[model samples]
Target: MERLQKVIAHAGVASRRKAEQLIVEGKVKVNGKVVKELGIKVGENDRVEVEGIPLEREEPVYLLLYKPSGVISAVKDDKDRKVVTDFIPYIKQRIYPVGRLDYDTSGILLLTNDGEFANALMHPRYEVEKTYVAKVKGVPSRESIKILERGVVLEDGKTAPAKVKVISFDKRKQTTILEITIHEGRNRQVRRMLEAIEHPVLKLKREQYAFLTLSGLSTGDSRELSPHEVKQLRALVLHGKNRA
Candidate 1:
């Protein structure tokens, strides 16, 4: 059994938060009874409806795509650009990206049809780590690195603390390659963060999300995640919530 809102979300009717709102607004029904309570739980045998539409739950699918630069992260794009879903033409489930990677940023991106799992992993409270390797224009000073480690102010607000390391320096080209790990999913965050420290990124690629990596996959390659991997990810967010 699961919370009614969770079941609604799992069916892809809405996000968990939105599902709660729908329940409160009396738009959701369980077994033909309008359910306005947020805490109600339902079993697999229970029938659910949202906005008078019966829920149809699809089997969840999880995928890791080594996204190439210049492709959209969404299932479809308004401007008709190529999207991440285009890489997996054979997948039948209606999966969406868990979070976003910038159009120009490439590497480890997760796609899933499990709405509850996606919500948990993307929730701010869970703090799922994302690691990126960036090639920036200039070598940063130790003080600048420290500033990043502490947190930097952006247009939206101050970023949370980040883990940054200088991987290499190119004296001839006057560029630096560094790795930065952050949990926030702000738009253009990695680029903006480096820009805050006066080292604009020349190229950026995400290398990891949680413990998952783009180890064997090349650009535009993808694979279904193993069951164990999915279990581990779910456990990670659950454990994170417990710790929080």
Candidate 2:
């Protein structure tokens, strides 16, 4: 069963908010009866109609879109900037990003229409790891890496300890490539962490999330999640709950 407004929006009639307004106006009918209640739930065989027209049900969609830097991570950007949704024009479902990516950061991003799966993935207890490869202004010494591993003080609070490894150093360019992984999703965290250590980031890109990797995916491309991949992701979230 699903919320009437959600089902209506899923049929591409209108957004969820608009659907709610339509319901309040008594324009929605289910099983040949008007339903004005906001909390109403309709089961799979229920006959749902909006303005006497039947709604078409679409299967849930899960997709991975390589978010390019400068694209906003929102369903619709008020600034008229391009959004991640623009990258997947072929998909018709009202899918949303699971979490978020910075407007200046690029890499692996997950989009889905399944609210339960998104909740499971974003829920703090899951401790899903997000990994990034960062190019910094200068090489970080062992002491600095240790400090990042211990956690840094931010405006909100101290961040969770992160795993940091120096991938390479280029003396000529006075830069270092570091692979940093953290379980917490803070705003501009990787760049902030590097800046806190006096080695500002030149470039940053998320390479992995949980067990999912951006293998062979160039920025701006997207693909549907395979059934097995979806199963594994759900299992990971459920296992986290079991442990809790």
Candidate 3:
């Protein structure tokens, strides 16, 4: 048995903090009896309801979304702008984004109801690699490439070393597309790194994170991860420390 608030939170009804409030408000019930105690225990066999609607234990859900440009990576937007959750109308679990993507950037984004899994993927200690394809204003000089390989100083401080490679160059357009791999998830790291090298990024899209990819997924579309995919992700989080 577990605390009612924790059980509700684990079932994705709400966060643990919010669930406690609901219990105090006397809006939650177990086995047809109103339960207002914050520390009340609940078992898997117990029936739970909130606001008269029966609640079921939520199964873990993991999804990959090809987030399009102009959408914020949040569950709710106070500004009323489009959010990543808008594309996932069918997901029943109260999941949240694993990490953030800039409003103008596009590509692979992971969403899950498993907080432990999300923490593992987002934590820098795991050092999960995120790959991005960036279209920059101009080709970076050899020295600049070395600077990036070693590490470049952003406005904040020196960034961690990143793997940079020229994917292709468009001479006529005066643009160069580069593939960059970084382990840190600092805000706008790719764009800032390119700016530091005097080559402003025109477009950026994350293509992969660790073992997850955007392959077979289209922009603005989302799909539940397969069982194998979910298992692989959990393993990545649990064993990432050892691997690192």
Candidate 4:
């Protein structure tokens, strides 16, 4: 037997939270009976349906979104702010973001309803590498770069070592594009690191995460991840540390 919400999520109905909402709203039925309780259990012999459609356990769905600036990386925002879900129209499942992007930060963000996969990706032990491109106020000195590459003391103490590469310097634009790769997903770590070195980031965009990239997707748009992409992401979570 499995929890109803878990079954609903595994069937690609929604995230566990949303599935519970569906249950509470009397939209989900099991074995031809409406179920409104959150912790109701079900077995393989039972039948489940949502909104009149019989639910089937789908192959786990994954998506890569080119999250635009000024959008919150949350499934729902109480303040009525623009959320990443606003751009994903075709995804009927209640998938949530694997990690997060700041309201003003844009780049590759993963969305999925697979609970175990989400746990593995977000867990600190995984240490999945995330790469970002930051447009900063000024070109950082070699010493500054070294300090960032080595590690800097944030309010939370010393940060993990990150890989910093000065991609290009534009004197005319008075901006520098630097690439930073880090394994830990601290809150606003990239921006804080740059701030610590006196290089405030003007704009930031994540370019890659482990095996996934925001290659073909445009800003404010998303695509359902192919099966191969989903498998690759799962592999990254399962074996990322070994390769890292």
> For each candidate, what is the lDDT?
0.92, 0.87, 0.87, 0.86
**Candidate 1: where is the Cα deviation over 4 Å?**
none
Question: What tens-digit string does per-residue lDDT give for candidate 2 at 1-244?
Answer: 8899888766656667778988999999999999999999998899988888887777878899899999998889888999999999998888899889999899999998765577668776877889999999987889999999999888888888999988999999899999999988878888888999999988889999888899878999999999999999989888888987
lDDT of 4 at 185: 83
Candidate 2, lDDT over the whole model:
0.87
**Tens-digit lDDT track of model 4 for 147-223:** 99899999998988999999999998788999999988889989999999999999999999887888777898788
Ranking by lDDT: 1, 2, 3, 4
Best by TM-score: 1
- Which candidate, 1 or 2, would have the higher TM-score against the true structure? 1
- By lDDT, the better pick of 1 and 2 is 1
The TM-score of candidate 2 is 0.80
- Residue 109 lDDT in model 3? 94
Per-residue alpha-carbon lDDT of candidate 1 for residues 1-244, written as tens digits (9 for 90 to 100)? 8898888888766788989999999998889999999888898899999999999878889999999999999999999999999999999888899989999999999998888788889887888999999999988999999999999999999999999999999989999999999998999999999999999999999999999998888899999999999999999998989989
Q: Note each model's CA RMSD in angstroms.
A: 1.5, 4.7, 4.8, 5.7
Error of model 3, residue 185, in angstroms = 0.8
What TM-score would every model get versus the actual structure?
0.94, 0.80, 0.79, 0.77
Output the lDDT of residue 156, model 3. 78
